[model samples]
Target: MTYSGAVKVGGAADVHELADLMISKVAVGPMNNNAYLLRCRATGEQLLVDAANEAETLLSLIGDDGIASVVTTHRHGDHWEALRAVVDATGARTYAGRHDAEGIPVATDVLVDDGDTVTVGRVTLTARHLVGHTPGSIALIYDDPHGHPHVFTGDCLFPGGVGNTWGDPEAFARLLGDVETKLFDTLPDETWVYPGHGNDTSLGAERPHLAEWRERGW
Candidate 1:
């Protein structure tokens, strides 16, 4: 089946295949957080993004191949609900944004910053720090040599708008500015967006609504 990027808790994950990477996206926990399991086709090395919840489910997905690292995109509780369990079970090194490392319960083996690279086998993904949703929320960028770029955006972005700022205008502006400058302005329209929650969208589909999102001040 074609990968639609729409998943639900207790359902099978949706898998997207690339030349060198396989991305499996599943929704877990009550918050319906999206957890991504990335596998490098060349070496079978794996990396998991946001071990949100349902440790058993995650472990089942991991199977015997195991993962080298578990990257928590932000410090939000919902995003790392199963971090400890997953790490303990897989013995994977933990990675989180530098500024938000202290907030996450699990000890961060690596503190990632904007422009830092995380490797899964021979494939490398660049981290892009997007503030506002959280002090240290980050989005991972995978530039596929044979296809469009793919971005795993944590709570910093969603299909309809940026993450909620709880009515804080300053926070909203900061997030919007960062998203516009670092994401929309820099990435091509075909970039695929896998958000922390809900269905996926592309930069091209969202670019036309930038001014509208800013005006709404979400």
Candidate 2:
């Protein structure tokens, strides 16, 4: 079946196979958080993005291959609900944004910043820090050598608008500005966005609504 990037809690993951990497996206927890398991085809090394919830389900997906690292996109509780459990089970190193590391209970094995690189086998991903949704929310960028770029946005950029700012105008503006400058302005239209929740969308599909999202001030 074709990968649609639509998943629900307790359901099977939707897997997308790239040239060198295979991405498995699954929804877990009551909030329906999306956790991505990235496996490098060449070496079978794996890395997980946001061990959101359902430690048993995540471990089942991981199987015997095991995992190397787990990255928390930000300090949000929902985003890392199963971080400790997953890390303890897999013995994976933990990574989180530098500014938000203190907020997470699990000791951060690595503190990521904008432009920092994390690797799964030979595949390297660049971290993009997107503020406002959280002080240190990060999005991982995988520039496929044979295809369009793929971004894993954590509560930063969603399909309809940027993540909620709780009616805070300043926070909304900062998030929009960072998204526009670092994401929309820099990435190509074909870039695939896998968000922290809900279905996936591309930059091309969302670029036209940038002005509208800003005007709404969400």
Candidate 3:
């Protein structure tokens, strides 16, 4: 229930730490949704991503420091199972992609669009709206002071290729094109990728397979 160690899809756990921020993740629910807790080291302000499941465990992880806000990656059911509970408990503001906000069961406080920034004390995360997986699917980009960018991709992207497009060719094309321009071309190879489920990967590791993924078209 608690975040005991780093979580991997099939390999070793990967942990990421930056100058003034710390990211801790736990895989929850039957779908193995990955929920993240980001804390500002200097201000102790925190942010939670997904709130996928296990409210008690998440609350414990949050503890007394409390949370500034909760950002839902997409409209998927697995991603917001614990959202209402966490929001009620912490009174933290809720943010979601504008187009996808209505899809979620709970109300969203702030409707974030592309380029919007969410701040937790000194830490700031830029919201990038990556469409296709859903009309408003989004990824959060954090430029770590230590080095490269860290992206919370949700289901829009992953290690081997882009997230499932559910056999929709048009959707696949949109997602792929956006990913290449918004993520691949823009971010460096060292950018870290954290998805809604499964292990983490880097832009460097997946960069080489772009053509292959494009050819395969998933």
Ranking by lDDT: 2, 1, 3
Runs off by more than 4 Å, candidate 1: none
How well does model 1 score by local distance difference test? 0.94
How would you encode candidate 3's per-residue C-alpha lDDT over 1-218 as one tens digit per residue? 43233574333223356788888887776787888899998999999989988887778778898899999999999999999999999999999999999999999999999999998889899999998899998899998877899899999998799988898989999999989999999999999888888878889999999999889989
lDDT for model 2 comes to 0.95
lDDT of 2 by residue, 1-218 (tens): 89999999999999999999999999997999999999999999999999998999899998899999999999989988898999999999999999999999999999999999999999999999999998999999999999999999999999989998899999999999999999999999999999999999999999999999988888
The residue ranges of model 3 lying beyond 4 angstroms of the native Cα positions read: 1-15
Candidate 1 local lDDT, 1-218, one digit each (tens): 89999999999999999999999999997999999999999999999999998999998998898999999999999999999999999999999999999999999999999999999999999999988999999899999999999999999888888998899999999999999999999999999999999899999999999999999899
TM-scores, all candidates, are: 0.99, 0.99, 0.93
Q: What's model 3's overall lDDT?
A: 0.87
How far out, in Å, is residue 174 in model 3?
0.4
lDDT of 1 at 178: 92
* Residue pairs clashing, model 1: none
Count of clashing residue pairs in every prediction: 0, 0, 0
